[model samples]
Target: GATPSIDRFDPDLTIRGLLEIWRRNASLKD
Candidate 1:
């Protein structure tokens, strides 16, 4: 099988990573 994505590793880590992405997205919208 193929390697899993970040969220597949751990829920907590996925949430933190997702928050970072959201912040990046917000900045891009500015």
Candidate 2:
């Protein structure tokens, strides 16, 4: 077992965060 933190969160959160970042960057390009 391991303690989860920003450096070790569940994969889902990481992917979602990356998606949100990408979306925000795309919006700024318009």
The model with the greatest TM-score is 2
State the lDDT of candidate 2 residue by residue for 1-30, as single tens digits.
434465687789888988999999999998
Expressed as tens digits, the lDDT of each residue in 1-30 for candidate 1 is 434665367888878878999999999999
Q: Could you say which candidate leads in lDDT? A: 2
lDDT per prediction? Answer: 0.80, 0.84
- What is the C-alpha local distance difference test score of candidate 1? 0.80
Error of 2 at 22 (Å): 0.3
TM-score of 1: 0.63
Clash number by candidate, in order:
0, 0
